[model samples]
Structure formats: structure tokens, C-alpha cells
Target: MSGENQAKGNAQSSKKANCCQLTVDEVGLLKLKLTILAVLCVILGAFLVAFQVLSFMRVENAETERMLIEQKNRNDDLTKENTKLKTGLQETERMLIEQKNRNDDLTNEITKLKNELQGGKCADGWQYFDGSCYHFSTDTKNWTESRDACVTMGGHLVIINSQQELDFLNARREMGDGRSQRDFHWIGLTDAEEEGEWRWVDNTPLTDPKLVQPKHTVLTFVSAQYNSHSTQFHWFWGINQPDNYKEWGPQDCAMIFAGKLYDETCRSLKRICETKSCMAGV
Candidate 1:
């Protein structure tokens, strides 16, 4: 009976020891699970922080790119504007040069005209116009004698070359006031060679018949042969002039009286003599 009691006590003690060991194992497993959970939480927090930082970096890069694009656009605009300004400046300079050239040409033309006018001079006792010299006679003579006298003086009877010359002669005669009864003068024209055909002293043919028309139509007496004239040939005629009247016996010569011409006898009359410059001579 004592042996049985001892064995039962021993079994009870062994069972108690086994239960304490089980309790210790359960505590250690629980600690291990808690440690693993902590480690997973730390890893999740670190991942979240890294994601946020990466997002900020992306945003900064995008903004930098946008600024660079704007700067490039501004640079392009400035370049275009500079090119336009350069072109405008070039055009302005060209226009100024062209205007200066035109002014220079005008100045040269004016100087040339002045020289031409100043160079046209006549000898003493002779009036000058367009390079010709004219002399008025103080003595009277027949047509032949007058012509001879003009030749001796190195000139000839006045031959009308232009309407301006005619006007000048008429004005001169009016100013002379040296005639009585009639201001008749012997010119260098005659029809004595051919009866009806008139000739100048220089032997040029009298073309333009309208030159001797009536005084009313005389103003329209520009040459029919010439379309335009810088100089003109004309005639001044009296009333019923050059009639070839038998009453005025053998009137084949022409004479001027008071700027009007008439067929007359080669009697004594005042005359005009004309000479040309060496450069203007035939």
C-alpha cells in the first residue's frame, strides 16, 4: 500500500512539470508573432514615404520643362523682330541715296543752263541774242548799195531766222525813232531771181507760204512743214503786199516799213545788218 501511494505522487509531480513547459512554449510563440507584425508595419511606412518623394520630384521636373519651352518661344520672337528692323533700315538708306542722286542731277542741269546763257556774247556796237549780232544803219542807201555796205562792214542785210528775232528787230526799230514819213528798211529777201519765188540772202528757199498771209491769219503762221519748232521762220506783211502791181513798176524787191513788208523799187532805205559768231557761222 505504501509503494502504491508513492508511485501516484510521483506521476502527479511529472504531470505538473509537463504543464509548466507547455505554458512557456505558448508564451514564446506569441512573442514571435508580435515581432513579425511590427516588422511588416515599418516596411509599409517606408514605402509610403518613398512614393511621396518620387511624386514631388516628377512635379518639379515638369515645371522646369515648361519654363524652358516658354524661354525658347520668346527667343524666337525676338529674332524675327530683329530681322524686320534690319530690312527696314536698309530700305530707308536706299531711298535717301536715290533722292541725293536726283538732287545732284538737277544742280548739274542748272549750272549748264547758266553757262550757256553767259557764254553768248556779241562784239561792240552790235546787239547779241542767241549767238547772233545785229547792227542798225545810220545812213540810207539803195538795196544793192546797202548790201555792199553791209559786206564791207563784215556783215549782210538782216535775214530773219526765227520769230523771236523778228520780234527783237521790230522792237528795235520802234525804239530807234529815226525815220520820217515811213520807217522803211531794206531786208535780205528778193524775188528778182525767179519772179514769184522768193529767196533769202543765204539762198534758203522760202517754204511756208502762210508766213506772208494776211495780218489776221499771221498769228497761225507756224511752219506747216515742221511739226514742232524750237525756232521759227516767219514773215511780216503789209496790207495788199507783194501784189506785183504794174502800177508800182517792176517791184521785185522786198522792204520792211513799221514791221510790215511790201514789194518795192530798190530805192534808198535804212537797213539792218547781221553777223553770226564763228561757232554759229554756216
Candidate 2:
């Protein structure tokens, strides 16, 4: 019985020893598996962080490219505006130059006109009156011959326009040294084209018949003194003159005697009166 009991105890001790060895092996294997799992978790976390960083960089690059494109567009617009301004400025400069040239031409024209107005003159031995020159011929000739003579002197027969001009001619005639008050001088008036339609040498018709009245009253002083009696004289015509007198072969010309006008033969000899515009001086 005692030996059997000892064998059973030894057998139990061997079984217990085997069981402890198995437990140790199992714990060691568990520790190795934990270590491997920890290393794998660290590698996975590192990969996730790298992926996030790459995504952020891509977003920043996209934003920078967009800004660069916008800046390029703005620069192009400014260049176009600058080109337009330069063209407009050039056009304005051209207009200013043209205006300056026109102003210079106008100034030159004004200066020439001023010089002409100040330098107007007339020939010597010609009387200047009313912006015209007059020449009274001393030689006697027919009406046609007198007119030709006036044309040779660069003038035409005198044309009386106003009462003041007639008065001036009368005063000049009274002041003549050897002129008679009754002396008849050939005038520019004529009716050769049509009877009773008097016209001047300039082709201007007589519009006022009062200028050639047959008679008029004149007030004159009898003595040379200032306190002399005033006398009246009658200006008369030669017996119904300008009656188309056939006796002298159709008198169609006009003459001036004193301050009166008369019709006479065109062939009659008379002094001439010529008139022309004043000449411009150099």
C-alpha cells in the first residue's frame, strides 16, 4: 500500500510540471503577438498623416494658379486702355496744329487789307473827291471825241450822282479864271438810244426829273458888301429846248450851262469831264 501511494504521488507531480511548462509557453507567445500588433498600428497611423498632408498641398496649388490667371486678365485690360488714350491724344495734337495754321493765314490777309486801305492814292493833276479822281479837259471836242479822249486817259465821262456833287462842280466852274457862266460843257447824259429816256455814260438811267428842271429861282447879292440888297434871278431855258429840233439834225446830247442842263447837237464841240477811281499805291 505504501509503494502504491508513493507512485501515485510522483505521477501527479510530473503531470503538474508539464502543466506549468505549457502555461509559460502560452504567456510568452501572447507577449510576442502584442508586440507585433503595436508595431503595425504605428505604421498605419503614419501613412494616414501623409495622405492628409498631400491633399492640403494640392488645394493650395490650385488657389495660387487661379490668382495668377486673374492677374493676367487685369493686365491685358490696362494695356488696351493705355493704347486708346495714346490714339486720342495724337488726334487732338493734329487738330491744334491745323487751327494754328488757319490763324496765321487770317492774320496775313488782314495785314494786306490794312496796307491797301492806308496806301490808296491818285494820279498827279487829278482832283480827288469822294474816293474818286476827276480831270477837266481844257481842249474842245465833239461828244464822241471827248469820250474817246477820256478813255485814253484811263477814265470815263463824269457821272453826276447827287445834288452835292452838282453843287461842287458849279462852285469849281465859278472859280475858273477864264470860264463863262453861260459856257456849255458836254455832260455824260444822253438820249441817243431812246428819245426822252436820258441815261448816263455808265448806263444808269435818270430817275429824278427835278435834277434837270428848265427853270429855277436863285437868290444873289447885288453888291460885294455884306449889307447889300438880295436880288432874285431867273434861270431860263432856250425856247422849248430838247424838242427833237430837226433844224440842227436831231439834238440828242446833253450840256451844262451855269447850273442848268440843256439838250444840244451831238456834233457840237464842248469841253470834257472825266472821272475814275483812285489808284492803289505800291
Candidate 3:
């Protein structure tokens, strides 16, 4: 009975040992499975993080592209404006140059006209219009002598038809010194030849335009009047009675210097010849 009991106990001990070994093996297998699961989870998480990083990088790249495009548009706008400004500046410079040229031309024209009217010794330059040289007097003589002198010179005395004609003669009075009948003056008109006929030495009839009262027919304050018969005088000069250089010539003849019809004088009056002239235009 003792042997049998020992055998039974041994057998039970063997069973227990086998069960423990199985448990340990099972536990180790479970631990290995758990470690593999943890590793898988870590790998999945890393993949998700990497995917998110890639997505953010893509978005950043898109935003960068947008900024670049905007910057490019702004640059293009500035370039266009700069071109427009350059074109405007060129146009203004051209206009300024054109105006300067026009001004130069006008200045030249004025200078030329002045030299033309300055009386000179061409003698032909002294020709009278309205048949008179009253604006300028060459010398003094009696009214009778003046008429005769004008006749001989081929021109009659100056007859003032209007105030304008008178003014033209008066403006040039700077040429002479003697103006008074104390400096006896010469005149084309007189009761002398035809009394009140008032005929020019040229024999042209004289009509009083302004009709200064008590006026005569061939009234020549200065040398030369539109004569019915003749029309020119040279070598003969007349004077204003008072030697007045104003437009109201009433000059027997007068002295004129600065401008046209520049008659310079004769202490001794003589008869000469001349043809009537036009004021620059007549």
C-alpha cells in the first residue's frame, strides 16, 4: 500500500509540473503578441503624422505660388506706368522747343521793318505822298517864293486834307531848328496866283476836308500839295510860320528828319523837281 501511494503522489506531481509549463508558455506567447501590436500602432501613428506633414507642405507651396503671382502683377503695373511717364516727358520737351523757335522768328521780323523806314540818301526815299513834305522842312522862304519853288521843283506845296495827314508830318519834326516866321515860311496856297482857287502847283484843286475856317485853296503849310497841274518838288523847301512841328502844319514848308521824307534845309530857297510819293503805302 505504501508503494502504491508513492506512485500516485509522483503521478500527481508530474501533472502539476506539466500544467505550470503550459501556463508559462501561454503567458510568453501572449506577451509576444502584445509587443507586436504595440509596434504596429506606433508605425500607424508615424504614417499619419508623415501624411499630415506632406499635406501642410502642399498648402504652403500653394500659398507661396499665389504670393508670387500677385507680386508679378504688381511689377507689371509699375512697368506700364513708367513707360507712360517717359512718353509724356518727351512730348513736353518737343513742344517747348517749337515755341522757342517761333519767338526767335518774330524778333527778327520786327528788326527788319525798323530799318526800312529810317530815311536815307536814296533821295527817292524822300518822295512825298499827298504831294507834300511838310512833316520835314528843308528851309524857310516867303509863301510866294515857296509856291514858285515848288512849281520849279515839279511838286507843289503840302496841303493838309485831314488831321491824320497833318499828324504824319508833325511827328517827324526833330530835323529842324528854325520854325518861326520870324523865320519867314513858304506855302503852296496863296491868293497869289488864282486868289481863292487854292490850286496845287500841279494844278490839282484843293478841297478843305476838315474845312478849317478861313482856309485857302492851295494851302501848303509845308512844301508840296496835290496840284492840279504839277506833282513833285526838289531843291525847294518851305517852313511852318511859327516853325511849329505839330500836325497842323499850315507850313509854308517844314523840316523833317527822324523818319521818312527827311528834308534837311536851304538857307537860300531854290526851285527843284520832285514827284509825289506814297506814305509807305500811300
Candidate 4:
């Protein structure tokens, strides 16, 4: 009975030892589990911080790219405006150069004209008088033929404007033999368009009161009328002048005969008196 009681006490001691060992092993396992949890928390926090930094860098890069695009647009606009201004400036310069060239040409033409005027002389065979040139033909021709000849010589029938001019023409007339009819030269006056009205070769009306005559009135041969107030001599008609005499055909032309005006048939042969501007000879 003693032996059985001792064996029971030993069995109780072994069971107590086994239970203590099991408790120590469980505590060590709990400590290892806590350390693993702490390491996992640290890793998660580092990953979250890295993600935030990367997102911020991406946003900044996008903003920088947008700014560069806007700056490029502004540079392009400025370049277009500069090109337009250059084109306008070039066109203006070209127009100014053309205007300057035209002005130079006009100046040269004016200078040449002035030089010609200063010479104050007509061509050879042309007599210069009162800023005009005169040509006297030695050939005989009818009134119409005489006019044509004068035009061919670069002049028209003579128009006597003043007493001095008529006197100059009278001094140059041909004097025939005393027994024969007086030599006559064709003048610019004519009454062919209308029987009563008279005009000059230039289509100017006869306005000089001294030279006007009563229509169809026969006049006696007389000297020219003198104006004492102006100290000038005026034209007068000869005997039976401007009668429209049909015996020798219609007398539609005028002639300077012995320093007097006379109506004569256009078919009558006569000398020519032509006058022109001095510049015409030049």
C-alpha cells in the first residue's frame, strides 16, 4: 500500500512538469507573431508615402508642358506681325523710287524747252519777228494752192495783228512795173462761209471795228485808217472791194494789194504770205 502511494505522487510530479513546458512554448510563439505584425505596418506606410510623391511629380510635369505650348504660340504671332511690317516697308520704298524717277524726267524736259526759247532764233530761210517766224514764197499759186504750200512749209497764211506787223509785211511785198496791175499776196481773211460775215483762217471772227465794212457796200480806193489814240494803223477796203463779183467768179478770198485789202476770186494766182510760231521752226 505504501509503494502504490509513492508511485501515484511521482506521476503527479511528471504531469506538473509537462504542463509548465507547454506554457513557455506558447509565450515564445506569441512574441514572434507581434514582431512580424510591426514589420508589415512599417512597409505599408513607406509604400503610401512613395505613391503620393510620384503623383505630385506627374502634376508638375504636366503644368510645365502647358506653359511651354502657350509661350510658343505667342512667339508665332509676333513673327507673323514682323513679316507684315517688312512687306509694307518694302512697297513704300519702291513707290518712292518710282516717283523720284518721274520727277527727274520732267525736270530734264523743262530744261530742254527753256534752252530752246533762250536761243531766240528760227531755222534757216525763216525770218524771226515778234516771237514768230515768216516765210515768203517766190512761186505763184491760186489762193487754195497757196494755203497748201504754206502748210507744207510748216506755217499757215499770215494774220496781221497790229499796224507794225502789217508794215513789216508791206515792206517785204513785190512791186510790179507801174503800167501793169499791182502785185497781190493772199492773206488769211475770207468771206466764203457767209457772204456778209468774215473770219480768219483760224476760225476767229473779224472783230476789229476799223476793218469791218457795210455788207455789199462799194468803197472808193483809200488809205488805211489811223487810230491817233492808240497810235496804230488799221486795214481799209479798196475800190469795189468784196462785191461778190461773179464776172470773174465768186470773190471769196482777200489779198494784200499795194498795202491795202482787196476781195478777189479764189482761183486768181497770187504770192503767199505765211507766218508761224518761232518754236515751230525749232
TM-score of each: 0.47, 0.45, 0.36, 0.47
Give stretches of model 1 more than 4 Å off: 1-120, 177-181, 214-235, 278-282
lDDT of 2 by residue, 100-201 (tens): 999999999998886555345556656655656666656678888877877788887777776666666666655565776766678788889998777888
Tens-place lDDT per residue, model 4, 220-278, is 33423322222242435664466777797888888887767778888655554566555
Clashing residue pairs in candidate 2 (N, C-alpha, C atoms within 3 angstroms): none
Model 4 TM-score relative to the real fold? 0.47
Q: How many residue pairs clash in each candidate?
A: 0, 0, 48, 0
Q: How do the residues 67-153 of candidate 1 rate in per-residue lDDT, one tens digit apiece?
A: 889998998998898899989989999998998999999999998875555355545666766667777776889888988888887
List the lowest-lDDT window of 10 residues for candidate 4.
224-233
Cα lDDT, all candidates: 0.74, 0.69, 0.50, 0.71
Which parts of model 3 have CA positions greater than 4 angstroms off? 1-12, 102-282
Question: Model 3's lDDT to the true fold?
Answer: 0.50
TM-score of 1: 0.47
Error of 2 at 235 (Å): 10
